[model samples]
Target: MLSEGQRIAGQYTVERYLGRGAFAEVYRVRHRFLGRQAMKVFKHVGSRAAAEELLEEAVLLSRIGHPNIVRVFDAGIAETPGGRSAFFTMEYVPAGNLEQYWAARGDRFTRIGEAVDLLIQICDGLAVAHGERPPIVHRDLTPQNVLVGFDDDGRPRVRVSDFGLAKRTDAFTGLASARGTLAFKSPEALRYRKGDSPAGDVWAVGAIAYLLLTDTLPFHDDSSPVAFFGVPRDAPPPSPQIRNPEVDDELARTVLHALEPNPARRAADAAELARLLRGWRNPETRQ
Candidate 1:
């Protein structure tokens, strides 16, 4: 817990506590020269090894430079009241996560065009990750990890954050280790315990698209203990049109295509998905 007036790493002066997560506590901080930024301080107190591990994540963030990915400014080991801690500063996103942004819009249905636009931005960011030499897979892709920022025109923009679960496709790891949140897992991912892949991320993008338009999960069911296991093998998920009639058939079909059970049948990658979304015809008045 950083105090409001405390300074760390010889530069950042804590302004206020922002929020806490399972592994870190975020704070709003002011740099002596860099102005305002968000500081993510690891919570594993007194563990030099833990701090070192977090430094690796910071390095990864720094390497993955994209307009839609949160930017890392600085990171290092810092002395704290509790002990030495690892902290990183990132570009602060003011509008909060996509989950909060969606909720703030109330129960009214989001415009289909607008929802697709947001998904396109997300895919654009992930495509950059996938475009890397070995390809980076953002295993965790959910509303909670998406930050809604704003453009110079005050229009809502989005950036992907929380890369703690990201992994390079070529890196050797346990087959099951590359998974993310259960609800966003692809059917094949859940069944085979496979780690991150382009197909897996494409599935997540489809799920997020479904969520934005319908305000519900694609495989919605509460009775089953395992969400993926409950998916009907005899039939595909209910079409987005079933939940929100306003969704165009082509748009619904495109999103559902990304959620195909077979990885081979899914969208090739985030770039492909983004291209598909970009093709949707504008429903409102044309420019």
Candidate 2:
């Protein structure tokens, strides 16, 4: 909702509106001295206590600092045209998100090696959170939540972003509430059967990998009325190779294993998935 040129707390000047979700609006802003950064302003406007609650995402990102994770720089309450809004600033990646990157591939599927590499980087980032004392679960893991950019050497660099729904699991249950994009959610999460855990995050990673390889969701069927509710539970998703013949058995197995309907059968967590992906060679370099 912030217009370009607007200044927040006299520190960051809005460059442009990036996007918005259910509860927050993101803007590309320029820090007075620190160059460019992205600012996320929570929609809720209220007292200091409420603002503090909205700043949880910033706090969470600060604690889980990793090269594959977006970095939070600052957080505070800023006066907006609407009212006092809670805002946080983080590094801005110019190449946009994974969704855009995937879409740009158009009719062609992402290269097997490139897709696997990206997934591995994503897992690396999530692994840090999963390794936390109580274990943090990124309830929302979608292409839109992952930022894609280039490093100084021009190699693709991916960072897990949008931690708005991320939370540390309960010490006793090791579970967080079931909440995320339906297409990427685990069967257990969609049914509210076991809440959500590290396994649920792994499901999302698998879904993303499947999409990258096949250019379609693993279990999505637009024609089915049940699709609105969640993935069909009675049957497992088809292997990625079925849609894309280029997908080899080893890669297909790795992707399908992550999409297993049973959490117990899926890849243990992001760390395990990363390890599995490391074995695959980039298609362009495969001998």
For every model in order, what is the number of clashing pairs?
Answer: 0, 0
Displacement of the residue 187 alpha carbon in candidate 1, Å: 1.8
TM-score of 1: 0.90
lDDT for each residue of candidate 2 in 128-198, tens digit (9 for 90 to 100):
99999899999999999999999999889999999999988889988898887878888788776446899
Question: Per-model C-alpha lDDT, please?
Answer: 0.81, 0.88
lDDT tens digits by residue: candidate 1, 197-230:
8778998889898888888887765235665553
What global local distance difference test value does model 1 have? 0.81
**Highest lDDT scorer:** 2
Scored by TM-score, the top model is 2
Overlapping backbone residue pairs in candidate 1 total 0
Off-target runs (Cα >4 Å) in candidate 1 are: 46-49, 107-110, 171-176, 221-225, 228-235, 281-287
